[model samples]
Target: MSHRSFRALGVALVVWSAAFTTEQACAETPIEQARHVFETRKYTVVTVQLVIKRQYSFGGRGSQEREEKQEASGTVIDPSGLTVMSLTDVDPTLMYAKLAKTQGMSDYKMESNVTSVTILCDDGSEVEAQVLLRDPDLDLAFIRPSKKPVQPFEHVDLTDAAHPQMLDELLFVNRLGKVARRTYSATLDRVEGIVTKPRTLYIPGQQNQESNAVLGSPAFTLDGRFVGIAAVRADLTESTSLDKGLLAVVMPAEHIAEVAAQVPPLESEGATDGGSS
Candidate 1:
């Protein structure tokens, strides 16, 4: 072939490669677009402060009581300050009970009482809140502000949700700990599997371990559709091992919404503070 002909062919190939690379680089993945939307909208990812008191009894060993203050991530589901988070995060009595039984501690007993509940707002304000309902079967806890807010607060619309399939990538948002200034952060996770029997559950990929997603964080599809909240499932059957039974799964938003609908209207006064499940 002539040198001129060879030069023209090489230049044509280079231009084609460059155009393809640019097109690929310009395209954003679904999760990436969802992240942008969440960031711009300033989704309501709040911090929940829980003050819990616990009493422990070990048969003849007698009883002991203690109190602790903890913070957990929660997603605001409505303008009225209705929030949802992992029940286990607020109270771990059931988890402890399972552990004790697993260890064959027939005489072990434990109880937890949520002494105080507060929602930390983005503007550095604190809103007094209380547990409105608790669903242990689903590991979900719904909370609401004690008093009506002067103005509606920003929240995620769980009704507009997405159903993810196995291996599909998803996005979740959570608030960082105090050390990180309690900033809202987003992470990407893939659906490792889907459980259809009993109830629908999305098993997040192991990559979630390296992510900042914590219990109660809201998950969404790459298209920015609400998926559900992150929670731990504890199966305490005699045949199931603890390691295999307890799994981090994303509860379907539909289930959450159905349960949320069951939450009674906010009372004129705060609901009775009781032990969280």
Candidate 2:
């Protein structure tokens, strides 16, 4: 072909390629759109840690020993550094409970001590965090740390009326401190029924504590609006996989007000909460 003809063909090809790229960029599905939002705004979440105090099973009157356990989770609820997590995960307050291995009652004290929480952003900025509030029954915690907040996140929409399609693909984002676990999906086999406080799988007894969903892990529809704070699996019936019973109670955003009424907010940078006995 002549040089002029070849140059014309190359220019036409470049024009077509640019148009295709624009179309692809604008036509992502809702889930794909949501994932891109998270990837761009990941800098606003953080991981928390604390020194949890535990008394020995023995009826000791002095020299109490402390256990320092670290938990990793994520949050994107606020521009003021507020984070979201599992309600039962971090408790710093000391409380009363029965002594271990005996009929004797004793004080089971704990503290909600936060070491440091840092938000890793895409722009190479790491922001620190602190605890805010957590709902006991619903199992969601709101945290905020001490640092200049980053830009507001691409907050998910919370529809007043929404329904989760059965067998639909759901996405869950998990975190381990500063490290992030990849978002995963599961097939909703069945409804398994609902409860007043979305809890772990167990006979409604006073002493069955087998809750599962990781704290701060958010569950959502393919469109990415709020669905529920992850709840524990409810079925203990034998299945091919152990995870068959580990169901997370997807709380609708409307229920957020009810949970807030029960668990009031605090005004300190330190952490505080009592574990259920």
Candidate 3:
């Protein structure tokens, strides 16, 4: 073969090899990893609705009534439709604080009227859910759907997930806002560090604009193991000045399972009475 032809063939081979490697890397990306995990566990993540009522008196006037609706993400844990969501969803103190300041009300009080707690299913159907327990320490709440579906719902076994180490790559699943068709987003982040004071935690590297949306969303390892759920920690120790930001942390699966096991069982049938080890 001519020298020119030999050089061209070698270049073509190199290009092919590079292209193949790039494709492989893309397939294993954190987004892809998150998608794979979600596809299998889609039914576990659900939408929750909370009905709130507010009572306030202005300028020595009698108490008046105000109504509000709030929504949040929850994770189903059992066939009986046990689920967990953020405590702030049902009890929003910060939201009320802002409202009080804005309206200039002397006495502002808000409580969950909770006329109904509806659970949005994976198949786009809705069902009634009931609040069973609230753990203030963890800032987590447990709930159960009132009626059982014909087919058993899927759930994430928190104990099954592997414990993550520092700097490990992980993926989390979060649903878009109401304007968005409730589609889930797969987020990739590195474990920036850990804090051992309150509990063993997995902290994300940097804060992003979408960080608030991912709160209460479940995080997973690349191989599809549940690491924990995304939580926020506010550090005001150093900052007496004014600016306050939230740091994302992973509430480890083991800890979640331990707390979940103690939650009371539903009144319905076919529920697991055994503790989650």
Write model 3 residue lDDT over 202-245, tens digit each, in one string.
Answer: 88767532456776778778887888777655432333212344
- Best of the candidates, TM-score: 1
Give the candidates in order of TM-score, highest first.
Answer: 1, 3, 2
Q: Tell me the whole-model lDDT of each prediction, alpha carbons only.
A: 0.83, 0.46, 0.69
Backbone clashes for every candidate come to 0, 16, 0
Task: Output the worst ten-in-a-row residue range by lDDT, candidate 1.
Answer: 268-277
lDDT per residue as tens, model 2, 1-277? 9999999999999999999999997798756766754454334334455445554433445545556666555545534545566654564232112111122343434334444445444355656555555565555656554644546653333344245554444444544433334333222222334454543221111111233434455555555444554533333332223345334565555554345344334343444332322
TM values, all candidates: 0.85, 0.54, 0.74
What is candidate 2's CA lDDT for residue 75?
Answer: 47
RMSD of each: 6.6, 8.7, 7.5
Clashing pairs in 1: none
lDDT of 1 by residue, 1-277 (tens): 9999999999999999999999885797675687686785445779999999899998678789999999999988999999999988887788778777766776788888898999999999999999878888898998889998997988888878888888888877888889998988877779998999899999987866433257899887766678898988887755567767678899898889989988878765346663444
User: Using alpha carbons, what is the TM-score of model 1?
Assistant: 0.85
Whichever of 1 and 3 has more TM-score, that candidate is 1
Report residue 108 deviation for candidate 3 (angstroms).
6.1
Candidate 3's TM-score: 0.74
